[model samples]
Target: MVQFLNENGEFAVASKEHEIYAQFIRDLRESDFLKFYRDMARIRRFDNEATALQRQGQMGLWVPAVGQEGAQIGSGHAVGPNDNIFPSYREHGVAITHGVDLMSIIKMFRGVNHGGWNPYEKKFHLYAIVLGAQTLHAAGYAMGVNFEGKVATGNPEIDEAVITYFGDGATAEGDISEALLMAATTNAPLVFFCQNNQWAISSAVETQTKVPLYRRGEGFGVPGIRVDGNDVLACYAVTKKHMDDARNGLGPYLIEALTYRIGAHTTSDDPSKYRDAEQVAYWQARDPIIRFEKFLRSQGIGQDFFDEVQAAGDQLAAEIRETTFALPEPELELIFDHVYSEPHPLIEEQRAWLRGFEESLGGHTPTDDGENKVDYGGSR
Candidate 1:
């Protein structure tokens, strides 16, 4: 495995042979390390709180990103503000790093919004639930950037690159294959970031492919590298190099982050049925937050710093809980509002029919609390 910080939190000595990969971390400032620690810790706290909320029936479903924080936060920090990110549904850590409102994501799981935030404003695309679909979207967006003459502009601020996140399961989808072809043939400035998080809803990585996931990228004519995804330093170094290459008009690159899915696939999943307890314990020993915490302490960071971050995380959780409960459910009629930019006869006819049907069944009435209460039996 490619690792800079070992499991014991000690920095590994780099030989002359691996200097190219090691150089990405050689110039790190003290603040950079602290930021990485802070981001990872905050996301893990959010993940835990969200999972608890789901168990408490506050959310419809929740995807826990506990173990993979190193991969997501490291890669998230590597990209500049101009770069666009396309994320699969479980990229809450990456979203947090990009300054996405945590409540917006909470609202999504609460089933109040289709996507809770504006994508263009954050340079982070909405979460794509359909597997592997975002890869094609990312490729297309990157191609558009190329067509707009954003590449080779000699201006880092204007030269944009696209990064798409997916899991080991998504690699099996035809959309990912198509995306690879599109990116390779067009030479689009894109990066295919695959977090090979051990299990795709109980189907092990062994079942997905015979060879390593990164090797598949090589077959598609894009250079691929596998990194120790549990090590934030290694993930940061590798991703930073590839993202820079893509922005420089070097076409697409692939990174297979070898991490483990420490939690259930989602709140609805039961990993106990398929996976063994031993496997979970092994990965738990390699917890990214714990490892990163050790590294920070070794650098003279004290308990006070950690305590401050923990308190901040606690405040964020409280805010998310408050906002989630306050979010109002959208009315049935509002769904048709954004279906078309201009008036459409078909939409208008459907909306009218639905309204009339509701009226015939004794339309919803306002309750004492100002909520619309629909009576299934009859009109109030």
Candidate 2:
């Protein structure tokens, strides 16, 4: 695995094979490190707040990306402005690296919005709940980029690529294989990033695949590499190189980030049911945020900066909680509003059925003109 930082937060390149990846971060200033720390801390705080909200009956569900912050934030920052990102449900850190609002994610879990952000504006696509499905969407988009002569355009601003994020479990899905085949066959400008978070819900990653996941793409004609997902610097450098290569028309590539899922898969899951305390403790010691903090301290960062980050995180959590509590109950008609870009007979029929069903329940039904028509069971 490619690792630039050890568990003790010390700088130790793992091997000569990945030593070259370190050069990508050679020019990073102290400010860059501060930004990285700030973003990681922010996303982690958001995750904690979201989880609390879910437990308190404020949101329906929450996917915690606590342990995977290094992989998500590092790779997210590596992405270029013109690049496209297709994220799985647990990429809150990646969303932060882009311009995605934390409230948009909160709204999604609140069941009031379906990924409120605009993908075109931020280049960050909606969260994909289905396992491994975003790979195909990313492949298709990369092919479109190739067709439009976007890759290898010499102009850095015009050249583009696609990066799709999925977990270790998603590798077993056929959609991932099909996407790999498509990208390889077409030489699409895409990078497949798989965060091997050790567990797919209750099932450990060991049972999911026999071979190293990065090598899984080799048979499909796409080369692969494995990086120390817990090391932020390594993750950033590896993703940066591959994404840059993809933009230069190097075709599809796969990066397997070996990290751990410290929290439960989602708010609904219970990790204690399957995982033991010892394993959890082992990973906690290598917590990404804590390790990154060590590195920052070694660089002479003081307590004041840490204190400021803590204050900012606390303020953000408070704001998110307040906003979530104030979120209005969504209208019943919201489910049918964006089912399609254009009006369809089937959707119209479904809408009418819902309207009638609401009326039968002695409830007010929303009208097209934004008015609520109260049904009196024909008593009036």
Candidate 3:
């Protein structure tokens, strides 16, 4: 069923098997393919650097979206400027492509704030860390689009849609089930994109399901399809088509992207405890960034293009390291600022007390030990 992409990283149309992607790819030119290729490269570089920064004691924690770039970039392109995206924490690719400040994402890893930006203001929502909970918000948001007249206005340019991402482990949650039921019944203009990176933390895909996750959506009466989660082109083409479908009021579709999670679930995890060494080595050989770059070069993208993207990626990584390390630690007073938009009298009194306490301590300030410093201004 995953035959759309083979070991050689070549793609083709297999009848009724990846037909949607097969048809979609025929419409894309080499230039379109390069967009996905470039995104995958940049985000993977960012992921690696973030991991390094965390190990070097610069970040609070890091979530490596290393092998999941194809899933992230493919679905991300389906979104328009007016559309909204709800992402899981590992969606660095989606966030970066949507004009999210690179340093803003860095701040989250730097532990300066829960989320670095407002979702509505950015057109991309904050990353959801609650297992599979974003599905419901995505459904409600899609329903809101309908209520707001954002879908099917006889003008595709004005219409909007959503692509919500989760993982294989998230499928078991009631929120995911309820989201599917609501989307199926309401025909919400959303795409439920599952990046089945073959693991839910420590659990493997086989344990997560007896049948494929895409097929599960069929029970809800939505059209579901599987993609080569590593095949960036397939991911991009199928997702763009489905998002266009939602914008056209064709209703929700499910995409179960099949890929391997090459890194531990997060920096806190150790894959060697649960996964076989050979299995990890095999997927590493088939890494999405390397495979996509190979396909892009095969399609006539030059070594210069590769070199240019590589240079840009390296710069972005270094910038992430420097900027994240330099991000201001939240002012001691800011902890009380956003807690309530309208401050309570008691809260204000407590803030006053804390301020007085700081003043009494000689304006107690962190003295940088040359290695650790905190920046208060957001995402510098």
lDDT of the candidates, in the order given: 0.87, 0.91, 0.81
* Candidate 2: tens digits of C-alpha lDDT, residues 334-380: 87888887766666667777877788897855576633344334332
Task: List residue ranges in candidate 1 displaced over 4 A.
Answer: 13-17, 356-380
| Candidate 1: tens digits of C-alpha lDDT, residues 347-372 | 65666666666766887432224322
Scored against the true structure, residue 204 in model 2 reaches a CA lDDT of 94
Which pairs of residues have clashing backbones in candidate 3? 327-375, 328-374, 328-375, 328-376, 329-374, 329-375
Candidate 3 segments exceeding 4 Å error: 2-5, 16-19, 364-380
User: Candidate 3 residues 223-327, lDDT tens each?
Assistant: 788888887777777888889899989999999988888888888999889889999889888787788776766677789998888999999887887777667
Q: Select the stronger candidate by lDDT from 1 and 2.
A: 2
TM-score of each: 0.92, 0.93, 0.91
lDDT of 1 at 308: 92
**Candidate 2 clashing pairs?**
none
Q: Using TM-score as the measure, what is the rank order of every candidate, best first?
A: 2, 1, 3
Model 3 residue 98 lDDT score: 90
